[model samples]
Target: MPDGVASVTLEYPKKISRGRYFKPAVFPSAFIKTVQVHDNVLSVAIPRGAPDAFPHRMVWRDAAGAVVHAFTDPAF
Candidate 1:
């Protein structure tokens, strides 16, 4: 976390299984504000620093700690 950082909200699709449940993705920092699930969409809120030219990578994992999704934001 850094000074002048702003809070960000991200949304993702919630995966459902017959005999298993998907938990909210775990973030590396404790500054995460809230995690909400509604209408099959998962919303995550956290603090983010100012944007730069370099791409920012976001990684998501399942309950087993296995990476299930990854994305790079060029604008953030």
Candidate 2:
């Protein structure tokens, strides 16, 4: 999260197959839901059906809808 971040988006990972030769790819999990920022602390609920093995992403955005900061849990 950043100083000007107005909202935080919780992205649940969804696995996608690439091919038999290459590993799978993970993409497009932004804006699935948003959480409120209170006193610079954000608390969001993970969906019941969200994948437990993959790490989720948090995308912080400003009021102008520009991404201010983004990070993924487990760093992978």
Candidate 3:
């Protein structure tokens, strides 16, 4: 988060498949705070068998109310 953003939403993969392709799914608004009130850890369960399975996306707004997004990496 930029500026003074305190919380953000996390979108993860969801298991929903058809014949040969899985339907697109987005688990919205998994709240994550930048400034930890009690603990400084965030955890989320990733769904199996999606195109962007491991690289989950997080969304939030900056102080100017501009949307900001980030991708999670396993290497990090």
Q: Which lDDT tens digits does candidate 3 get at residues 1-76? A: 2444534555443332233564545444333333211232445554444444444456554545555555664332
Across residues 1-76, which tens digit of lDDT does each residue of candidate 2 receive?
5577788887765654446786866554523678767667876665443444233677888878888888887634
Query: RMSD of model 1, in Å?
Result: 17.3
Q: Pick the candidate with the highest lDDT.
A: 2
Query: What TM-score fits each model?
Result: 0.30, 0.54, 0.32
Indicate whether candidate 1 or candidate 3 has the larger lDDT.
Answer: 3
State the number of backbone clashes in model 2: 0
Task: For candidate 1, write residues 1-76 as lDDT tens digits.
Answer: 2222132233322221223364433335433222322433455433433221122454544444455555655432
lDDT of predicted model 2: 0.65
Q: Which residue pairs in candidate 1 have backbone atoms (N, alpha carbon, C) closer than 3 angstroms, thus clashing?
A: none
The candidate, 2 or 3, that scores higher on lDDT is: 2
What are the lDDT scores of the predictions, listed in order? 0.36, 0.65, 0.44
- Strongest candidate by TM-score: 2
Could you report the Cα RMSD, in angstroms, for every candidate shown? 17.3, 5.7, 7.8
Candidates sorted by lDDT, best first: 2, 3, 1
